[model samples]
Target: MPTITISLVLTFATPPSVGAGGASGTLADKVVARNAHGEFIIPASQVKGKLRHACEQMLRGRVPLCNPPRAEQMCPQIDKDDAGNALPQKDGLPCCVLCQIFGSAGYPSRLRFHDLVVTDADLLPPETLRAMVSLNRRRRVAEAQRLFLIETAPYFNGLQFQNSEAITGQVDQPSHIHIVLAGLQLLFAWGGGTSHGLGWGDVKWEAWLDGQLINKIDSEEVKQICLS
Candidate 1:
């Protein structure tokens, strides 16, 4: 089994709105995900979602479950129609690579991520209050008067996990873990406002096997396997 430790220096490029579902305070619209510890944290679920999407992009049609004959119905690539019914794939299968590793409807993901916790609370960026408005299509001007505050960590350090269970699964496969780490670099944003370009981070990955460090992301082997 390999224990993967990722050190991330996340520099928020834009305001992120992970959304606590509702808003409060004088500004009253700001929402973000926070931990019971009262610190902003990125959940493991979020990381998993990002990794899955990144894998899809990097692997393209290579994932068995994502490819035709198997993905037609089960793949996330398939979208719902106007009536809200899901369209079928031309050829679908029981599972894709994502399903195999991360699990799907019937399976459980082999990969696990520990929630990313902020290292220094004081280092977190101060919350920013901004005026919210919608664009008017007719006049192309800002409309509607809404105020919200967004708590964002413009710069901070955090820790996350990528554990590879040795006995229960096949971590011995070279392509399996290598491909996964590569997918991390492909992740662009976390939380919300991603479409508007926010939450980008520089992540450095390291791997340990049996209590001994085995790989650093910058290593030549990793460069060839992951970066290339």
Candidate 2:
């Protein structure tokens, strides 16, 4: 049940004006919108679609890399409208949709909704596992919806319980933080997963995670129906 809050910081607001000879603008001004410690939402329909498609790709034994490859691993072409100037997405397509469940329709590129001030939704991963597990259970979606309301909650998944693992520049912890270090190293490293891999590590990790999901859902009738 490894989970992280995934406090995304992607901005989607408009960029700033250019100075003399296309110099530059402040990074913040250039950014359209960004949230470092905030939560965003995606339409239920979208999440369901993305998850199922990606999961199926994973099940098919291929890593599901998002289109465009670099920007977003899920949504594609988030630039502009048919006439330019960011198009109003259907219920905020590119941005995650969970944030609007609490009333964020008017907060462009903002979604602090689904308040977790007194809940465990954070720790439990915003019902991903559960949502994926219970689409068409033993009863109507209406019934399942109610039960979900009862069970849905916010939780702190961060490692706050343990003494914060401070790196003293040694052991398992490195002294310096390298940006995209993990991503770059694993981008094409042909190695097995954590279990063991000389040059097969990256692919092995992908394959292992892919195998785990289906195995986890082995007892899920809802998953079977949904994915079917």
Instruction: Find the candidate with the highest lDDT and give its number.
Output: 1
User: Where is model 2 poorest over a 10-residue stretch in terms of lDDT?
Assistant: 159-168
Over all chains combined, what TM-score does candidate 2 have?
Answer: 0.17
lDDT of 2 at 163: 10
lDDT (C-alpha) at residue 207 in model 1:
55
lDDT of 2 by residue, 65-175 (tens): 223223433233343423333322434453212111111223232211111111122443442112222344565464434332111112232211111111111111110
How far out, in Å, is residue 13 in model 1? Answer: 4.7
Alpha carbon lDDT at 52, candidate 2: 31
Off by over 4 Å in 1: 1-15, 23-30, 67-72, 75-93, 145-149, 153-172, 209-228
Q: Model 2 segments beyond 4 Å from truth?
A: 1-56, 59-68, 72-91, 95-228
Give candidates' CA RMSD values in order: 7.4, 24.3
Query: Tens digit of lDDT per residue, candidate 1, span 1-228?
Result: 444333334444455555444555534344566678877666667766777778667765332334332434544544443344433332353444555555555445555666565555665567654444556779888666633344543343342212233112334234455566677778767775555454555555555433556463433433343332
